[model samples]
Target: MSERSFRQTPHTSHDGSNSSRLSILLFIFIFIVLCLLARLVYLQVIKGPEFSQAAADSRTLSVNISPHRGTIYDRNGNVLATSVDAMTIYANPKEIEDVSSAAEAVASALGGDADEYAELLKQDTTFVYLKRKADMDAAEALKSEGIVGIYYIEDTKRVYPYGKVAGQVLGFVNVDDEGVSGLELYYDDILKGTPGKLVVQQGGGGIPIPGGTEVDEPAVDGQDIVVSIDIDMQSYLEKRLAEGVSTIEGEDGRAVLMDASTGELLAIASTPYFDPSNPSDSEVGSDSLKTVTQAYEPGSTFKTASMMAMLEAGVVTPDTTIFAPAELSADEYVITDAHERGDMTMTARYVIQDSSNIGTSLLVENYLGFRPLYDKIVSYGLNGQTGIDYPGEAAGYLSPDVDTWPLITKYNVTFGQGISTTPLQMARFYGALVNNGVACTPHFLISKPQIGETLQYDTEQIVENTAAIDPMISMLETVVEEGTGTGAAIDGYRVAGKTGTAEYVDEDTGVYAKSSYNLSFVGVLPDASTPLVCFVGVNEVPYERNTTEVFKDIMTEAISRYRVVQSD
Candidate 1:
């Protein structure tokens, strides 16, 4: 009877239990939602700065602002080597949406391979430099195309407007605007000014957004370098040397022009020279930097130094007579003149004019003892390095000590046999005699402080001997007028000079060989005022060619080009 009434009630307690279970599930869900909200709040508040900073870092861009490279000028302020502002193309590989298209565009404009450019653009890199140090015109042409992902950077490029005129001396720079060789390498720090930086905001693919201001540090330009090289003289010397070398058919030739009074190197030219603008194209072993760095037994050129020593030591006067023959024996070695001479008594002028090895050796052995002669050689700047502003300079070889002297050492040294010296040293030594016994240091840079101001440079007197000065001058004059160096004689110039022919030592056998010879000549013009002195060395002459003839052509051309004349 109670069952019928309960069925009608439909289990109210069970319904209440179901409602309680649903409430419990709702409470649990609410609790889970609150926990997630708390985590979101913690992340946004506690770790927010770190994430934001990371994002900012990703968008920040930095650009390098290259400084202007220094300008190279001649002594007269004529621009030789200069730097100009250039445009360079760069790319953000990550921003290149259409890698193939962008690379094809760039490759077409630059004459490179499209596949290689495309591969570069596919890299996951912030920057990929496409072309560096491009000229402004080329850069503008590329910019006009409006290629995507292509950007430009301003850089400085070293330019030699004279082409290869003074290329060897002026030097060259690398793609990054760094000095690579020549004067550029020697004075790199002074020529390369300080670089600056720019900070800007970048977008997701590493591309800088338009209207984004850049925080930039301006670059500093390098100072101008003025060299003592005369462009006209340099061009003339180059032309002459090239012609002479071509004519000799057996040897390479080089020449140097210097200011006899001040020892300022005016022009130094060597054949088979490399172009500074394209040094890679030059022959590897050619006379690239050999003028100052190369040393050889100077043959009779050293006779000038020996003559100066004899005069300074009072061992011989200009009129002092010395007997010369074909050969003379000193110790165990026999010294011979370039040409055979009979029993002849000649004056000091005659001794040098004939390039008499026998006479010069006798003066060294009988008159000026080993110590005095060696001291004179050292005093004339033979044993030390010339402090020229160049790289890879060498201190020429001299007898280490008198004790190490071989039996033939005195005789050999007398005629420039056992000793060696550089062309620069020879020029300076002879210049001292021509410039009133004041040996000035040879340099390439002419110091001109202010524009339109009187250009001034210091001169160092290496030797100061007044008594024996005049005779040395007379002897040098005789050399040009009626000496072995007669080929160097120029009309009305009163040329003072010396000639030399030395045997090159066989590198493998370590013995002197007659087959290979070095022909050299040194001369000073306008013997009165001594405005300029010149030295020339030609290497590896064959039997057919004469070294003296080469000297004549080079000297004549140089004198004519410089418009030099002897004083009245």
Candidate 2:
């Protein structure tokens, strides 16, 4: 090396640069180690439990177990509706290989459109329901197709034992096993039980892991409810109603039989009935429980309320006379009786016995007046709901302005034309007429008989004044003995009832139809301790061959069953 270059040698400079590089490398290595240690501490100490829980959750599968729906029984302990073990068809859309093919197979086996099932199977979620509460045979057929994503879940199906017997009153459940109408819908919360869950380890393909620990939470079954319905009586009523509806070529009919003393419903039947098991097959107007849901002008049957009001006011005695004509003009509207009885004089009792429209109208115009008559109707629960334990009950229409009410409204309401009422409401009101003037609230739930007990029901004294009711019952008794309700009489029993031929305004003309009539009859066994009150109404039927015989047939059976005897 040259002497001048020895002072600043390239080798010395290179050595210094190498030493500095090694120090920098060591510092970087130490810094990286510290960062690694801090990261380890954060993962192990700070977020360890949360990550572990997330991982556990990812592996666990939670499934809901449906509980058995409550059993519904008639008062005689016959099962009306009950839940049975069935299969619920479901799908794992994520696991499905071919949506169209799966949908086709499922729809073929289960009786639905392929397009609907395909849409359900194409969902982004892991689980989708194809059909809930499917029949075993159909669900099994679908399962046998060997579709990977298709699954079957154990579930309950509500089944009506008697099919169309008490279909309207008992109602039917939907595909999800939820009650949609009648007593079933009224007490749905009580009938539906708590659902439980099952948790187990799941694999990558959503299958249960081998030897995976399963945790279960058991479901609580719903409480059994015993209704005050008599299955035999219900069947009897339905048969008679259907026969009457058919015999007269009527549109439909409704009937209700009740224990007059306790206000407990014995039977409720409606014609053109639907099968509760296959509610979808029901006709448009036949699905409702007509006894409670359908309200119509009661026609001459409403004369009873006028009679009660007159009797209460002490304006008319049974022997008090009225001049009733075939046609009478009131409020410039001409009203007519059923038959042509040109200007005849009859007793007040005979007015009811004859179902005279003019006589009733005169009674309201003279003694009872408008306001007092309306008040009496209100007192009898005519203008309001009867408080029966049923859904969709109609509160009958009374004139909103009673004080300045038109004379037409007054005359029509007197004979049950302007006002409206349900068969159940009429039955309940008539119960007071027979039950010593105490109108009990009608109900179907007797008790939870499964627990060996009876449910307490509030029996209301809707009509406490017996002064009028006693005489009114006598009048009704006379009517059945020697009046229009003669066909309603039983052989050995003294029946008390009234017949009504109600008129309806034509849908086409908006005027009263001359041919259409709603024939109705209501009867009660006056001598029995717990009187059985029966009501029958046939809609759009001729008065000649309508519900009168049906009433007789039902009451005849009731007299035999209750052992009613003639004291006379």
Candidate 3:
């Protein structure tokens, strides 16, 4: 055993142990560095955006400020619809510490289920509305609660001052103050203005920081609109039409009154009207503006168009006479008069006065043919929608392709038995007659471009000249004096109009109902000066007579409102 060998062995062992220890320490240091680098990448890249958004949401509160809706006014400056300040309750879900407790507080204040509100409070969104257009008292009470994460934003709520006076015309808004029907929907673009934004710097728990950075985009309020409806007249018509429907044993009633020359709708009424203030308090179909949306057969009221056709073609004069039997057989269908009558002779005036379907059919089928009558009606704006400032205006149906019509169709259309029309369209046609054969576009909004958007004034010559209206006017006067529309006569006023009784075509059967009938009357007051057309119709009327008296009541009120004087 040499001293050198012992020393070498101990050194080798000690050096090996030290080298192993150093290698292990270096490996551990490298592993820890790699792990830290990966954690850093995750925190800075993958989860960075999430954390940044959460922090931002807690540090700043951003909200949308609703703009004020435009006011709706009638022709007489009556407020039909308007807006008022309201509050919208919302929650900052990101800042809510206890979702259930916050939801319970909101529900108790707002009269809602706590579980339902809890679901909304637990949403992933930064902002959740507890209630839109909330009651002011309720909102104030909740504000006083000092609940964390609960906030409110100022908003606007729609109000109809007249309640149901012009519900179909004014319509109603949803909780968001958005129009959903009628003229409100038609002019929603002008009624609903641009929304603005508000950003407020906040501290922990979404609490507003005093004197913090605030950015606001001012809201642009909606422009006002003026329509032609007379609020007082509209109210009177509403009451009268409801009464008319009940008295006639009809399911519903509708009417339209307009300036004969200007085409401005003065009053529109429908039974079972919806309340614009409380939309839920309405019947199913009552929300619809039936005057423009629903259409039905016109019956003998359409004879005016045919009478014009005969006069325009020079086929008949007011004195021209025709002999009609009890029933005429054409196209294998028996055509009879509106009232049961034996063989009789009738002049043009008498035919109109009596509403003689057979006589009109004989004259049209034998003398003027159907083309002139069809063209005359289409020219008077009865063939399509009147282009009114209203939503859901239905275009009245007219049979096309004159050559394709059956022989009976020609005669039936002359008496209005086979034609369908709307009350608004009928009012428009009558307006043309009163305008001496010039059809003005029917509308509710008057042209006021300086204040808001409006359509251009337009007119069309329905006839070559005024010659075609002279004889027709004389006969229309005769109708109210002694004809079927005598009930529509207004004392001391020179009135002219026509009556209509049409069979309701059942949807299930696709044919005329045995007992149901649509009764209607259209009249014009002071046929010469400042004429106003009043048209009324009732659906599913069981009686033979139409709504002639309803027209009288409505016209009486209208004439009184306009201060119309007595005429010879």
Candidate 4:
């Protein structure tokens, strides 16, 4: 065979194999093209509505619709705290051109520093807050500038119309519209209403689409809260208490006035208080309320309890006589009267009138046994919280095992020296005394029944039981008439109360401070059947003067306000 013929045969066979391979490759390419075309058709037509809707949803932006917070009003219908319409300015940094120039223009309108806002506008984020709760006029002026990427959201800023009057009682809310302290924190749920939402379409580059499809859910405004605080009386009490603190050169002072008949708290004032409108500027310790929160030894004021217990237990009558000395050594502690006096026989009424510690110890140790006396004092709401509608109410500390009290504790507590009590607790106890043994729980909220609504809080609980208070009332009236509480007496009204001078322990050394005393006075006007109870306490003050002047001034104002008639 010729060589050319052999080479030609191999070449022809190779060409045939190559042709088959080309045909298969062409078929596979055509199949792939057909598959891709079918997929495109399916996406564009069969599932087009669903896919398009999903893509549109991805471009939509959701915004929170804030609700308007409630207004807080005092019992006299004075606005304490309310919300004002404001604006929140924001920017989409990505959409802004010339960040520096845009930031400056926005800052000029907002009345803010330009460099700070420029730094915010230089961010890579889609959104940044330029100013929160800006003035409405300022925000409107900025919007009128037609600056790109800047937007405004409607917001409500809390404002206190009566600045710093009841600041501690009416708490402040944070930037997020959350209550941080006082009544605001207590009624937060009722004040913060339900928030709604808004959804709107936006372009890929953070530009809002013109006439974009929007779904809106309107927000529900919060309900209004009316508290039982008498703004006028509250103001007066604050003024007097501040002056009293300054005059005594004391650490702090607190006062509470309550309607004895209904147990409605008229006023609760504390010195060194903070204005809730701008809580950021207030020091933490200054804002603390001492009336319901602080507890101290009640001193001679607790003698009323011992006297009452003796009368109730039949251990002694008003005329029952006891030998009282200047000093009586009981257990390891030596108990003494305010002033040195020779041993003399004194009635139970005289014992309280003179504020005699020795007489009180004799009555408790001999006449009224420890158990019976302790039980009687417990009945007066001494060792428990007064259930006031304020935050951080400390139930005055009392050892639970009063039935087995030590001799020193008994002797000290018999004259209000060892046991701790709050001004509120003492006021309630005295309220029970003046009300003839029926006293309601001290409360701040006056239950206002909205049409077809039930109140969230109840104000009717018997804090003190009906005991024979007529004799005690007469005895207390004698105290103000001729005893230690003369400074608390009104000209025409029959005032009943007791004076307290308690030595407090030094916080740093944990021992009794010779100079520091809590000078206090609690009084009640029992002229008519219904009484008005008032209590004032000054901390870390010398006992040169009692807190009777504050009580007198406050009660005089109260009598005029309530039109209290003078009794015989």
Candidate 4 regions exceeding 4 Å error are: 1-58, 213-215, 448-467
lDDT of 1: 0.76
For each of the candidates, give the backbone clash count: 0, 0, 0, 1
Please report how far candidate 4 places residue 564 from its true position, in Å. Answer: 0.9
Q: What is the lDDT of residue 119 in candidate 1?
A: 88
Q: Is candidate 2 or candidate 3 better by lDDT?
A: 3
Q: Which stretches of candidate 2 lie over 4 Å from their true place?
A: 1-61, 93-125, 137-150, 205-216, 450-453, 542-545, 566-568
In Å, residue 27's CA in model 4 sits off its true spot by 25
Per-residue lDDT tens digits for candidate 2, residues 1-568, read 7566446555434788899999999999999999999898888888888888789878876667778989999987899999998887777687899988888999899998999999998888766789888889998899899998676668788999898998889887776556788888998888878887767676775654657745478877888999988888888889988888888888888898888888888888887887888877888657688888878898877888889888988889898887777788767779888777789888899999888888888876877688888888888888778777788988898876887777788788898988988888889888888777888888988887557778666666666567777788889988888888888877767788888889987889998877779889988888675588999998887544547789999877767766666444
TM-score of 1: 0.85
Lowest summed lDDT window (length 10), candidate 3 = 4-13
* lDDT score for residue 504 of model 3: 78
117-145, model 3: which lDDT tens digit per residue? 99998888666788988878889988988
For model 1, the stretches where C-alpha displacement exceeds 4 angstroms are: 1-57, 213-215, 285-288, 329-334, 341-347, 448-458, 526-530, 544-565
Which of the two candidates, 1 or 3, achieves a greater lDDT against the reference? 3
Give the Å shift of residue 413 in candidate 3: 0.8
RMSD of 3: 6.8
lDDT of each: 0.76, 0.83, 0.83, 0.81
TM-score of each: 0.85, 0.85, 0.86, 0.86
- Report the C-alpha lDDT of model 4 over 1-568, residue by residue, as the tens digit: 6556334444335888899999999999999999999999898988998999888767876777668988888888888888899998888898898988897888789877899999999888767889888889998889998988887778888999878888888888888788887878888888878877767677887677778745478888777777878898898899999998888888888899987767788898788878987788876765556788777788888888888777766667777788887678877778877767888999878887878888888888998777776676677778788777778888766676876778888788888877888888888878876666766788776643332343343333232333546777788888898888888888878888999888889989999888668889998877564488999988889655688888899999988987888567
